[model samples]
Target: MTRVALMVAVMAVAAQIAIPLPFSPIPFTLQVLGVVLAGFLLGPRYGATAMVVYLLVGAVGVPVFANFRGGFDELVGPSGGYLLSYPFAALLAGLAAGAAANSPRGRALAVSFGWGCAALAVIYALGATQLAVVTQLPASVAVAQGVLPFVVFDLVKIGLAAAVATAAAPAIASSRA
Candidate 1:
């Protein structure tokens, strides 16, 4: 519970580190790092739950989204698809992490990388689609604006999230006992 709440707070903090792009409505933020970490550290159920709570908190008018903006409007706005995809992305990452928890370190890392890509795919798909619909842009333009600019940065975030989660896993497990 404490861990879950902590993730929510982490997400809120991360959202503040936003860099708006002139060409796109969506801002680049560290919120994805928090989402990936929540999944890799907390596993699927708790990871997804944490995202849901975070969304609910934001939906209720808490300024937890990027640039300190939040509300039901945020969830249904042009960037809403990205926000909506967090839970599924977290769940996907957490599922792989949980499955590989007891595997060899190299194998676990591989799984993390693979699943992290899948998670990013999910985020991109939903986010781009929604951006297209909400902004009345063509799909290609939406993909160009919403997904292309973030790939390298997001991949780095995934690596960082995986490394931190893997390193802390033993300590986290022991603490649970």
Candidate 2:
């Protein structure tokens, strides 16, 4: 429960750390990095629970979402899909980390990196689809508009998340033991 709350807080702070892109409705934030890390450290159920808590707080107007803005309206807005996808992404990332939980450090890092990529892909899939539907834009255009710009940055975030999870795996294992 404490870890879950801490993860929620981490996500809130991460959302505040953002750079708005003039070309996109969604800002570039480290919130997803928080999500990935939450999954890697907490496992799927707890990680996803953290995201749910974050969303509920944001929905209740806690300003925990991106750009210090939050509300039900934000959840149903242009970036809503991305917001909604957080739990699922976290779940996937957690599973990914769990898969390599017992591996050597280098192998764990590599496996976790793959899982991070998969988790990010899940986020993009849902986010891009909704962006296209909401904006009434062509799918390719929507992908170009919403995803292409962030691909590189998100990959970097994934790497960081994976590295941290790998580095802490021994402690995490010991704790579980």
Candidate 3:
């Protein structure tokens, strides 16, 4: 419960460190780092639970969303899809982390890398779909607007998250033990 609370606060703090994109409604945020880290550290169920809490709190107008904006409007607005995708993304990453945890360190790292890619894919898919639907933009346009610009940065985020989690995994396990 304390971990869950901590993750929620971590994510909210991360959300505040946002850079609004000039051309896209989506902002580049450290939130994804928090999301991926939550998954990598917490495992699937707890990871997803953490994300759900973050979303619900933000949705209820906690000013926890990016740039200190929150509410139903922010949740369903243009950036809505990205916000909505967080739990699923976290779940995917956490499941991978859990699966890899039993393997050797190298194997675990490889799994983290693979899962990072998959998590990013999941975020883009759900986010692009929402962007297209809400903005009435064509699929290609939506992809361009919402996803293309962020691929490299997101992958880097995932990689950094994986590394951080891998380094901390042993201690994390110890604490749980």
- The 10 consecutive residues of candidate 1 with the worst lDDT sum are 96-105
Off by over 4 Å in 3: none
Output the number of the lDDT-best candidate.
1
Q: How close to the true structure is residue 119 of candidate 1, measured as C-alpha lDDT?
A: 87
What are the per-residue Cα lDDT tens digits for candidate 3 across 1-177? Answer: 888889999999999988888888888888888888888998888988999999899888889998999898987777888888889988999987677787787888778878877878888998899989899999999999899988888888888998888888889889889
For model 2, what is the C-alpha lDDT against the true structure? 0.89
RMSD each, Å: 1.0, 1.1, 1.1
All candidates: TM-score: 0.96, 0.96, 0.96
Q: Which candidate number would show the highest TM-score if scored against the true structure?
A: 1
TM-score, structure 2 vs. true: 0.96
Model 2 agreement with the true structure over 101-123: per-residue lDDT tens digits: 76665588888988888889988
Ranking by TM-score: 1, 2, 3
Q: For candidate 2, list the clashing residue pairs, or say none.
A: none
How many backbone collisions does model 1 have? 0
Whole-model lDDT, candidate 1?
0.91
In candidate 2, what residue range of length 10 has the lowest lDDT sum? 97-106
